[model samples]
Target: MTVKEGMGEEPERYRVEFASGTAASVAKRRSFRDLERNDIERDLPGWPAQPPFKVRGFFGKLGVHVLSATTGLLMLPLYILAEALGSPASPEKRGELEERENEIDDFPVMWAGEGETARTLPWQLDPSRRSWRTVTEIELAEQDGLVRIWSYEDTGRGSRHLSWGGGEKVPGSEAVLWSMPRSEITSAEIKRFSMAESDFTVSFRDGSWARLTSSPHGARRIVALLGQGVPEGCHPA
Candidate 1:
């Protein structure tokens, strides 16, 4: 089916090719389960009533850190101080993020086509925008000619500034973070720094842009869905 702007097909217009339990990763399944249980949901304000994508949790995050220490080497600084201080969305902004989320029932999965929002930017590749930085993890759902980007943070990992511990929550954060009509998105592309490093760059009509990243597998899918666009002015990875 062709995607057009302002064409609100119906409530369930956004297709779900697979059911909720059909996640791409084990951590995703566990994380989403916790989200459904209400633990992770409360942390994310601007999120859909139903969660999207199954993401990795405690063990998953740990694995990334372990590997990043080795392979994500040299680029190690990218993980630190990448998310700026005071980066999370404000109360009003959180409400704004939820506004659109409340209108939808389901969200596109973590690895679905054009679901670039499912991944967040690596700390090193974070954009200057505060709104984007605070959202460490995210997903996208498209419907009625608009696409919604949901944000998640590991409340378990504490504040966006501190990666250690602050929250007792076991899993993640949930919120739409914000969304835009399809027309507002100028273009989408993937930038590659190495075999293990890649980023997704999406431009909005307001002259602002969001940079996002995910696992190596997810990054490739992002590039495939979004396509090859200009990367010269993109964030340094």
Candidate 2:
């Protein structure tokens, strides 16, 4: 073959050796510009050859492995810090709040009149709905075994304002329906009923004057009191 380079005819010859120690020489005459213009050093299709991969030995391999492990370890502490900072309350904070509430001796006694017998209750007292809050103060004075019951909206904070008087009446049959810790008695209005054996005091709601004999009844009362402003919990069944 004839080859031309830079306006001059030239002989282009090259030798290549294979892994098996076999060698071959190819001779041709072509323009150098053509060889430069086209890539001629690449293997042809179907030739069993692949590009070489550079491998780093021992220390280089160890360094990469250490770097990957170190990156993961560093990220762990950051992830933990983020979670700790974002959490609302730790377990200890919740426990402390509970303890403080339990220690509080003076909690207000609030009740809502919203039931079948609400209108009949004495405390049909809707403070929120009324334009002018009416506070009725009643004092119970027992004379000669006659009991007087009255209602009061004042006695200052932490003071109990409760009363129960429905004329001197025979005490109902003593039934120990339930007993709760003294702490559970949020608002207590005690009435002395003349029992056959002795005078027994009964605790009941100020509004309906219905005797609360079970924890469930007391729990319902507490719910009514605390859930007044909260719409979902305040609505009566």
Candidate 3:
């Protein structure tokens, strides 16, 4: 099978061709260009058109909204009483809120080379730590014999505001946290810690190990790559 990607006047499109003369095409909305290009692999047929609207449907939605508002109002006094009792404390200071928001705005974007597949997964380096979780980004390309992985810092460099109200962009450095050839890996497995976060660990023939936490999708991708006998273990332990 072969895959091709390109940009055109319309949305970015990808074409996949199989040797048996079968083919599939995918086109993503322009607004979602920043999302992982390979996500088309999981695309499914769109849902059928909605049924005609009915007065009963409208009243059903209205009833739901009314019930939700009534419940919220009923809980308001209890919420206020809890706050008055100093159960949850007062509102956070503006500076503290800004600091937290800055931390979130700094997350990094991981890109892959042509013909390569990459994904970023939520990760927790130290579950015991009170700080927020981090992320692990990995890329693999069998044709290029490449397997690259990077760990982005939870807190990124300060935000950069874009002109014309384009919002802000956070710049993440291109630093490889860990990398190794596909052929070096002898075994790989997921390790679960009682207090610490679970992580995927690759054991090398040289007796070294590299560990990383990843989302379920990322873990599956890593397992598939390791199954291909990619070299592993860039760091000791």
Candidate 2 runs further than 4 Å off: 1-120, 131-133, 144-202, 205-237
- Judged by TM-score relative to the true structure, which candidate is superior, 1 or 2? 1
- Among residues 3 or more apart in sequence or in different chains, the pairs in candidate 3 whose N, CA or C atoms overlap within 3 Å are 181-231, 182-230, 182-231, 183-230, 183-231, 184-231
lDDT (tens digit, per residue) of candidate 2 on 1-237: 113223443322111001010001110001000111221112222222333222335675566667656866876777677678995421111012111111121111122233312122232122222112123211111122211222223223331222332322124421221122322223332111111111111222322112211122332332233222222222112
Best by lDDT: 1
TM-scores, in order shown? 0.34, 0.17, 0.32
lDDT of 1 by residue, 1-237 (tens): 123334664222121111111111231121211212223332333433444334456776577557645755665455454545543322111111221221122222222112233222122122222332244333333444555544444345544444564533225445544455666666765433222434345654443344344554555554454455743432211
Clashing pairs counted in every model: 11, 5, 6
True-vs-predicted CA distance for residue 232, candidate 3, Å: 16
How displaced is residue 139 in candidate 3, in Å?
A: 1.9
Q: In candidate 3, what are the lDDT values of residues 1-237, reduced to their tens digit? A: 012222422211111000010001110000001133222221212312222212224555466567656967887787788888988533212111111111121111112222222212122222222122233355554544545554444343333221233222235733444445666556555433201222355545554333444544455456555663324322211
Considering lDDT, where higher is better, how would the candidates rank from best to worst?
1, 3, 2
Q: Every model's Cα RMSD, please? A: 19.1, 46.4, 22.8
Which sequence of candidate numbers ranks them by TM-score, best first? 1, 3, 2
